[model samples]
Target chain A: MARHLQDTIYKYVTMCLSGVALALIFIIIGVLIDSSYPALVVYGSKFFTSITWNAELTGSICYTSGIAHMCGATFGVLVYLTGTLLSSGIALLIGAPAAVGLAIVLAEIAPRRLASPISFVMELMAGIPSVIYGFWGILVLVPYLKSTLEVGLSHSLSSVPIFSGAVFSAGLLASGLILALMITPIIASISRDAMRQTPEGLKEAGRALGLTDWEITYKVVLPYARTSIIGSIALGLGRALGETMAVALVCGGASNFLPKTFFYPINTMAAFIVFQLDAAFTDPSGMSISVLAEMALLLMAITMIVNVVARLLVRRGFVSRPENLIQV
Target chain B: MEPDREPTNSVQLQDSFSFEGPVRPRNYTRRKALNLFVKGLLIVAAVLVLYPVVDILYLFAYKGLQVISISRLIETTAGAASFNPHAAGGLANAILGTLFIVGLSSMIAVPLGVFGGVYLAEFSNDNRFSSIVRFFADVLAGVPSIILGYVGFLVLVLRFNLGYSALGAAIVLSVLMFPYTVRATELALKRVPNGIKEGALALGSSKTTIINRLSLKFALPGILTGILLSLSISVGETAPLLYTAGFSDYINWTACCHTQIGYLTYVVFTFYTIPTTNAIDLSYLATFLLILIVLVINIVARVGLRRLSRDLESRI
Candidate 1:
């Protein structure tokens, strides 16, 4: 009877401990919504549309629908939203192709001895802290871009408005490139695993049909791993979107306006929250912090959607076991 | 000479030869060229992808080695307001504080995560509750660290009135570390084959006894890997700890609440922007230390995983 009771108690205890995850998610969402209530009520739908983000620190206090705020303090996330999307989009454009190519090389072209070491190196890259990336970005990439890429682009593509601009040390271009570097290892490793899983019989048939090695890879291997490759890219995209410190350091911290060119300053949603939070604490009306909470809410919702999509696609592909899913 | 008499036979021969001659060589050559070009591109892509990692490491080593020394490891950070190069100090405070905070967080998260994983792998069988927990754990993993920081600041620092304490930072770090541990533990436990359990059951051993004696022992290395990975993550994290932990120049060992703590990541983030040569050098040193620590942890984890898998193979 004692043993029976012990077994039952152990099961219940483990179950309750596991529920911590569920409780955590609920608490996070709950706190965000509860904190952002004032902003949500006041800003309504205009939060997405407006471009102004004045905290109105010096202005007199006012009330909008029972939420008190400094007068003329209008918050809008359009600039941040644009920055997040555009920077991540640029990262995807540059990273996805390079990652696919790297995957192909690792899976099809390189020998096992060579591939394993290179994959290890890439995993190390993934494990490197974000702050280090940001540190490297600020000290190295920003200056390098300013001196070379920006100057070269402006000179060569003078006719194209987006490519032609006064060069800055940090901006959309720097952030995008940094994000690309950050996401490449993630996309490459996952895609390489997926491509490696392609059936040998299919490649053999292609070879028998007089297909070259590259032809076999492109025609047989890539198509077989298509879903997984897409999933990996989406996963990379999710990382790029939420990447904070690196983007924050090199993003130039633009506000109240949208980026005008590739080299123009920008701020992502994730970065903006970090940048604005200290300042948000200054507003006596308490609405500024609430607005920041709303931004967090938006960012969370966006990442959640992307992650869900990525998981579905990955699950539909070769990796059915949950254990096999790569850590992002 | 016989062309006029045999026109139909000649036409048939010409048609058969025509089908084989021109098309095969032209198509084969084009395909071969295309294949070579793509292969070259793939090689280039691989090189490009690898260049940055090497560059970052080289850069850190080049700069960090110049600044790092025994004193740097033993001394505390200088005040943020002090800009004088002469007043610059070492990273002992940050290092110790990181150890304290990450250690505290590990103490809180490891058992919970391990137990949670055990539940998922052993106790539950596709029940609604377990599935819900699993799904939400994935969701929690996906949440941005900055948001976690914001929530941490709001709930722990402000509401709970911990006031930028080590305990607050540890709690936040544990939250960040939790999902990874649970997933890793569950996966490790699941890899334990069921045949052993069945055999033990036939011998009339209780389920709890089998888990405690057999499965836990087998999964120990994997569980350790998970804990190490989480520790590395906690060490590298900056966004979540930014507000919750705040920053300090000296190591405050006794106070868990109402006291700030220094960490390596904060130094890397804040110090470089300062113009002083000493400050920038210290930043590089901090970064180098971070990279070294994370690399060591990852290498240990990888080695552990390999040994565990080999052991499992030999036993099973």
Candidate 2:
């Protein structure tokens, strides 16, 4: 009876504690929904489709009215969302092949002694803070791209819309490159694990059939690890989409319209929130704050959607291993 | 001729064609070229992935070390002359503020996360409520941290009028760190020996006592690692703090819940933008310090976990 009572108490306590941790998510969503209601009522779907983000400089007076009344500045998130997708897409395109190649090296090609150190370095890179990447993007990478890469690309691929605009130091291309660098380690680590799981017997069978090493790897090993590799790519995509400070630093922060060229200045949803939220609070206008909240909600929605899809692809019905082996 | 080459077996082979010829040589040249190509690709990829790490570390060390000093570590930030290179101030306030805010948040997050992990690992079965919590926690773990800052802005800063308090920032950070702690603790607890718990239960020890006395002791190292890791993450976070803590030039200690706080990451984010020598120097210094602290924590957590596992194995 004493043990039973103790068990009951323990269960009750743990349940309550876990509930508190879980309820935080609900609290966040509740707060976002409640505060962003005004934006929802005013902008509706237009908030997402519109590309204008106007902020009145002289708006310290009208705290009661929405931002439109306080300043002539309009708030739309279409451009930011487009920039987010474009950069993330470019990041994935560049990162995926490089990650796969690195994984192949680690799993199949490199000497065991060399593989471990390289893997360690990559993992450490993963742990470096995003702000550091942003700082680097603003300083070293932007200049290099402007002076070298962009000039070269414009000369060769100038017929394409993405490569047409005059290349600036900080723009979509810079963010894409920074994001690619940031996510390469992630995709490589996951893909390496997945490739490592490929059965040795399969490789031996391919070899016995008189296949070359590259053929075996490309045909047998890669095909076997395809699902998990795709899963890793999805994970990288989710990371690229939501990464803030780094993207913000290099994305050029222009929210007027969708970027027409790779060199066009752009802003992402997260970056938009970073700058606008500060401005909104600095002024404390009702409309401005609500609009920021609305943006936050949209940003949350996009991140959550990407996360869910990625998790589904990576983890759902695939509980054979830990999906999030690399902590953010 | 040897017995194996004798003609007796050839006539019994039903008169099949018996002349053997040299087999065609395998295309070694093409295969070798392919191998070389693959090797080149792998080398290029490795270089691509590693160049940034080397570049960033080198730049940070070269730039940040020149500005770092004992006085800089202990002195207050310059109030008005923050951007002035000749100002007589340092990062004492930011360092202390980081410790205070992260320390407080750790206090809240560690206990809840640890206990929740224990519940998930020990008490909760694959029930609907537990599964739901597990799912949401997984999603929450992936939630872009900036969104957490926004939510904190709404609920804590705007609604509650807790304007830019360290407490508010801590709350947001706690939320951000919560999923990670729970994951680490749960994983650690799962690693604990089930026999120990069973033996305690057989001795008439209650579930709570078994967990508290037996399981928790074994899992302590792992739990500590998780907590330390979370603390590092909190220290490095800038966006959420920007929304909740708000930046302050001077450290405000007396009113922990009501006043703004400054941190290393905030300095790194805000100061790097201004085109001033002192501001840039401060940014670099803060970046170096933050990275150093985080890397140290990561090394300790990994090495400690390794040693703990080894010790556990020996005891077993």
Q: Which numbered prediction scores highest in TM-score against the true structure?
A: 1
Off by over 4 Å in 1: A316-326, B1-26, B79-84
Chain B TM-score list for all models? 0.89, 0.88
| Candidate 2, position A287, lDDT | 71
Candidate 1: the clashing residue pairs are none
In candidate 2, clashing pairs total 4
Per-residue C-alpha lDDT of model 1 across residues A87-116, encoded as one tens digit per residue: 999999999999889989999999999988
Span of 10 residues, lowest total lDDT, candidate 2 chain A: A315-324
List runs of model 2 lying over 4 Å from the truth. A57-73, A282-285, A316-328, B1-29, B79-85
User: Tens digits of per-residue lDDT for model 2 on B155-247?
Assistant: 888778888898998888888778777767776787788888888889988888888988888877777777777777788888788788877
| Predicted candidate 1 versus true structure: per-residue lDDT over B150-247, tens digit per residue | 99988998788888889999999999889888877887787778888889989988878988898887777777777887788789999988879988
Task: DockQ each candidate and list the results.
Answer: 0.56, 0.45
Model 1 C-alpha lDDT versus the unseen true structure? 0.85
Measured against the true structure, the TM-scores of the candidates, in listed sequence, are: 0.94, 0.91
lDDT (0 to 1) per candidate: 0.85, 0.78
